[model samples]
Target: MRKARLGVFKFTSCDGCQLSLLNLEEELLAVVDLFDVAYFREATDKPLRGTFDLALVEGSVSTERQKEEILNIRDRARYLIAMGACATSGGLQALRNWASLSAYKARVYPSPENVHALSTSTPVSDHVYVDYELWGCPVTRNALSEVLVSFILEKKPALRGYSVCMECKRHGIPCLLVSQGAPCLGPVTRAGCEALCPALGKPCYGCFGPKDDANVESLLSRFRLMGLRSEECRALLDKMNTYAYRKVQGENRS
Candidate 1:
């Protein structure tokens, strides 16, 4: 049987998600054996460019060139997977969506006109049809493995959409929100990090983005009850996964 041609592409991100793939170490060899790995700039100098069986795309579309590239990629790949917070929910850079891009550029660069960028950083799904999304600041190795195996089996990947609170329950970790009055976003944030922050006795920062049925307003109310200021609540929800959270707010209002 012919090996499935795989492609890994990057756009505007910290490259942490791709590092997670490299960190697979021993398992990475098996993945290479199973797929053709036609294009991965991080792994090779000479990359084969063409149609791909599967494309793992990281980072947000933050420029006109990236917008065109993503569209072209969609046209070629049989299956496209948007990986990490950047690809799925615009990552940390999505915070720029709310601010003045021109002002920021003018202040940061000597020749602001030379620095060309989109007004807003957006997820890959905003511009094209994505077969799957792997959410995280850097997606976990377990989730990555599960997605790869599911594709090989020609089955739907079991990417969980539940809140991080559920993961806390499974691990028998006490709720920090209730016990310590910590402003935790676990009730709204998507699971898959296995409640990593909460387990470590810290509040969840919603790095995986909002879950399918996240109630942002409700969570805000809980935060207020915990004596958190309106600004503090906004700051918590409006970082890392800000684009996704803002979208949730818009949907609820509509």
Candidate 2:
């Protein structure tokens, strides 16, 4: 029997999600045996050609080149999964959309005109259809494995729709917001990665993106009640998953 062909593509990102796959180490070998890696520039030098059974796309679409590349990849791949916060929700770079990109470019570069980029860094779904999405700033290895196995078996991936608060409760970890006065996004963020950050005594920065039914307004109110400034709340939501947060906010108002 022929194995499924898998392609891993990247655009503009820290490559953390891709690194998560490499961190799999031994499990990666097992995954390799199950799928033929048609394209993975980070892992191999071999050129990628033709269509693939599954394409794991990382990073946000920030340029015309990325837009075209994503469309082409989507057309060729049987399953297109947006991997990581960048591909699923525009990543931290999407914060630029909240401000003037031209001004930002002028301040950072001597020749702003030379910088060829889109006004907004957008998620892959904005450009083309995405079969599925694996969230997180740099997705967890377990989630990656689950998604791969589920896709191969033609079964829906087992991802949670609840908030990270559930995981915190499951692990018997103290509520950082209540105890330490740390602003935690856990209540509104998706449940995954086993509540890693909160368990480490750090507030969640919402690396897993928003849950299916995130209450952004209530969360914002909670943050404000905890003495977090409005600007800080705005900045917090404007991070990696700004688009997703904005979408929720828009929905709340409408």
Q: Write the per-residue lDDT of candidate 2 for residues 1-254, one digit (tens) a residue.
A: 99999999998789999999889988989888999988998898878699999999999999989989999999899999999999999999998877899999999999999999999999999999998889998898988999999988899999887899999999999999889888899988998879999999999889888998898999899889988899999878778888899989899888
Per-prediction TM-score: 0.98, 0.97
The residue-level lDDT of candidate 1 at 179 comes to 91
Backbone atom clashes (below 3 Å) for every candidate: 0, 1
Q: lDDT (0-100) at residue 65 of candidate 1?
A: 97
Over 1-254, each residue of candidate 1 has an lDDT whose tens digit, in order, gives 99999889999999999999999999999998999888989997755577999999999999999989999999889999999999999988888999999999999999999988999999999999999999999999988999999999999999999999999999999999899889999999999999999989999999999998789988898789879899999899787789999999888777
Model 1 regions lying over 4 Å from their true place: none
Global lDDT of each candidate: 0.92, 0.91
